[model samples]
Target: MIEHRITSRSVGALGSSGVDMSFLLGPAVSSINTVRILAGGGLGEHPAETWQVFYVLSGLVEVTGSDDTHDAPRTIVLEPEQAVQWAPGEQRSSRALVDSLVVLIEATEQIPSARPL
Candidate 1:
């Protein structure tokens, strides 16, 4: 069995902005189809065709979609045990309102393309 504490060393910073992501599972582990972990702060803009699941471990977060910049689309406040999912091609971003912990699950493979009409 694999077991370890979530430490600073295990955590990583994503993109040019946002929080540190603690990877509980990586590509090396074939059993885990996604990357699981704890994250904080804003996770910038997401890349196209990437699926993500965010689970709140503690505190709160604000998620905004880039599609609607005229006004606030919606804010999802996630507490401990709460979770949310994002599909491919969705333009979204997240930020920690308070010092928080979150589990981010992302698919290891790219989303398949659909046939042209």
Candidate 2:
């Protein structure tokens, strides 16, 4: 078993403006992170290579994205307790509409088929 304690001071940068994210210790096949964003901060344009989920814990957020066949972008607003998911190859970005805390969960491409945890 693995155990970790995450506090506000322990989170790290996510390369996005106004956003800090920290990975929770566990899961060899996926990533679990806590993300904090200040108002007006956001993640820039990026392509999804694996399944990803975002759950809002507080405040408001705007998620924008486009699928492979769609040239137009779709935007969604998420308030506290709301969630969103992205599929592989989907282009997406997110911004904090207000100060917010979010949880990010995603599956890595190279997941181990057999492993003991």
Candidate 3:
């Protein structure tokens, strides 16, 4: 069987992501990563590269995004088992309310609601 240590990719320096990011599935239809954020640390004051989903794996996080369909910004407090999605070109940002781990998924194509882990 093939084995991939997805989280080990974050052993080095943090990338431009602002948070600690480790790539999993990538350069194909979509890319998946694990983001580790310390309390008070965060990611982005930038637009989403594509359709993106932030699924909280542990701890609590505050996510805010701007949508073209709405005048006011959207904000969510994501807890474990909770997630949020952003459309392409939307402004997205996330802040860690506590030390947290999040599964980040990004794709230009549609993402199925459920998939084998």
TM-score of each: 0.48, 0.63, 0.69
Candidate 2 residue-wise lDDT, 32-113, digit = tens: 7889999999999898867666668899999988744466987878887566566677778899989999987677642222
What residue runs in model 3 are displaced by over 4 Å at the alpha carbon?
1-29, 114-117
Point to the candidate with the largest TM-score. 3
Task: Please list the C-alpha lDDT of all candidates, in the order they appear.
Answer: 0.49, 0.66, 0.69
lDDT of 3: 0.69
lDDT of 1 by residue, 1-117 (tens): 001133223333343444554433334222223222234557777653554555566777766653323454455566655555455676676787777776665654421221111
Query: For model 3, how does the per-residue alpha-carbon lDDT over 1-117 read when each residue is reduced to its tens digit?
Result: 001123422344444443554343334347778999999999977988777778788999999887555687878788876666666877778899999999988887535452322
TM-score leaderboard ranking: 3, 2, 1
Stronger candidate by TM-score (2 vs 3): 3
True-vs-predicted CA distance for residue 18, candidate 1, Å: 36
Q: Could you tell me which 10 consecutive residues in candidate 3 have the lowest summed lDDT?
A: 1-10
Give me candidate 3's TM-score against the actual structure.
0.69
